[model samples]
Target: MAQAGGRIRIGISGWTYAPWRGVFYPKGLRRKDELSYAARQVTSIEINGTFYGQQKPQNFAAWGAAVPEDFVFSVKAPRFLTHIRRLREVETPLANFLAGGLLSLGPKLGPILWQLPPSFRFDAEGMARFLDLLPQDTEEAARLARRHDDRLKGRAVLETDACRPLRHAIEIRHESFRDIRFVDMLRARGVALVCADTVSWPRLMDATADFMYCRLHGSEELYASGYNDAALDDWARRCRAWASGREPGDAERVGPRGARVPRDVYVYFDNDLKVRAPADARSLMGRLKLLAADGTPRR
Candidate 1:
């Protein structure tokens, strides 16, 4: 709503969780209305379905039409590229993934999250090559999408309604990614190093890009434990600091601070095992005063 320095978007990792039906969504709510309902509750949502497989262009268009104008959806790149191929010789896979209707989200598209597997350690050269393959803007993404093979000939949406800058965030699970050179490379590529909070994986909180992307999986347990009041308060404070282009005093940084420019922040809660993601997101939004009078996030 009224962010002091930069915009802060708090939301859940995904909206189609079965456990959230009666808890978050009304019992009788139609399945098709889930996205609309969730969009009204949070400023953004991380689309987890895309990580599993490629979605149809019509699906993306329908999803875009379901949300509010200010709402944003951060698409998770397919695991076929990140997990299956492990970013090796994936030009065609990457092209197919982008061409498979992501642009249909149009202006509502936010950052593209590429999550590396736990076994994938930091290889500077490999990482650099993969980052170089990523398109920096929608125009470039469209060009790359046009490289898709015959499989996507009839379905690929290569033309962007408005060519805007495309942002990417890398979520690393291996501890090797904590290297200073890794952070430097991401900074040079203008890709955000995701601040992933979890007890099972290495959590890196470096500020590398023009925006901040945070995923809170769990604090005490992975994907199960909800954030207590103290944890939410700390996150709110950090969100404010990042929005103002300043790192937290206790940040687990690797490289020296560079320019201090205000950055938009995107935070998603993934602790959905007990249906806590939505409540935690709402609480964090409340702490940040990002909710409207009706208790939904301000548009």
Candidate 2:
């Protein structure tokens, strides 16, 4: 198990879902205030809009302003690089993505998630090159952001508030990623292997980095099922174990566990079809004692 004093972040994949209105957000809550309200309810949120397309600097800045000082936002990398280009020759695309507006989030930015398509199999060389292209810190990210195309003339946020460490997490859907070599590669590169839980995909519970990133799409159903009390309890146990720098005894790992070191854990629920994501996240937070008496996040 991880050592004591590890941080655990619980949140939903996205906060802009229309179904979440009135269900998660209070009735008649202004759409613009939804992010703020949701931030109070959870510790972090995954910015899914960035996955679809590039956003303006102003948008990211506004999002940063909407959350609390300690609130964090994880970004989903653009589909243009993952789905369309399939991580091939994406230097310019990657640069454009960094230059777009992510830096505007500054200290509020958490991990940048790159989710591979279901058809993308594990290619050692290709995967290695892609991982090598990732920036390890905000300073390096700013350097890459400076290479953006003319699309972001005066709008790019190439400068960061501080040269803080940047984290990357990769979510693989193909069964090929189950190989131990992939986990070893992620560990060597300091990139986390996302523990994506879903009925249709392979669920590998390997801890390839100092931090654990999990995306709970659904356990019994792809994106439609809600986590029952038993499921939530199991997740809480696993999360606590991960945070303590130890793998759960029943973890489905690809490699042997190394020396234990405390690790932070980020878990997001993606079972939003029936408005279960937020509620499930909150429930898990409650189980972990992450919520205050007012139902807001404690930290």
Candidate 3:
């Protein structure tokens, strides 16, 4: 089908999973070809490895080259900043992460997900300061990367292609982030509040930015359960509404409603256990008319 409304991308969180190898991945497929294979079935993917430690520039380049020109990869920000520092005194760590070759993804880079630990409560001042340190565009990111300490001397990639807008999203697991002030702060900085659906997370649906980031980690179970037809039908409805610049009347919001404007929507299935992530992702894409029954783009 031809392009319509705001963009809607449905995909899995990460491409590599042992359980997904013989299941999601074709039997006998080489491990090295997994990313390219998954990219063809989904519109986007969230790179989870980047969250653990620094990734080589060559790795980023190879990953970028593996996907189609239109495919996008949302990189999870380092946990050292969120888990270890708890968003405090993270200027240098954030800079080091920026210097860690994400720029090599270039056009394939999507939102940067900064997922706070469940123990990290909402602190207005601390969150505000941390948000300020994030670069709004690729050029600004390169400038920040230039400030990296001696840690990234040899492996850092501080260069970027032509300037392009960069987006950031925060996935809060603690209930303290329910404060309207937190939502307002995110809105002011244009950072998206990730709508993470899980059995335990807060699952806030506030529209704090121009685009929406959603992670369906399984409603009844954290990462093992699958979404039945009825559940996915509901999600498809909400995705369409959000893409058309509207939120469900009953949406759980911490702050006032945002202005009506077209919004791009990115949804990733993080329920990777039992190989449900890719299955649900492809199903959602099919519901959105993005993919056909035969794994081809809708025509």
- Estimate the TM-score of every prediction: 0.98, 0.98, 0.97
Give candidate 1 misplaced runs (Cα > 4 Å): none
Pairs that collide, model 1: none
Across 215-288, the per-residue lDDT of candidate 1 in tens digits comes to 99998988989999999999999999988888888788878874698889999999999999999999999999
Name the top lDDT candidate: 1
Cα lDDT for residue 185, model 1?
92
Model 2 misplacement above 4 A: 1-3
User: Using TM-score as the measure, which candidate wins?
Assistant: 1
- For model 3, where is the 10-residue window of minimal lDDT? 1-10
TM-score, cand. 3: 0.97
Clashes of each: 0, 7, 2
Q: Write the per-residue lDDT of candidate 3 for residues 1-299, one digit (tens) a residue.
A: 22335688888888889988788889999999999999988889999998888888889999999998888899999999999999889889988988888999999999999999999898888888889888999999999999999988889999998799999999999999999999998999999999999999998889999899999999998988899999899899888888888887658888888878768899999998879998888788788889876777543
C-alpha lDDT of all candidate models, in order: 0.92, 0.90, 0.89
Model 1 TM-score is 0.98
Model 1 poorest 10 in a row by lDDT? 250-259
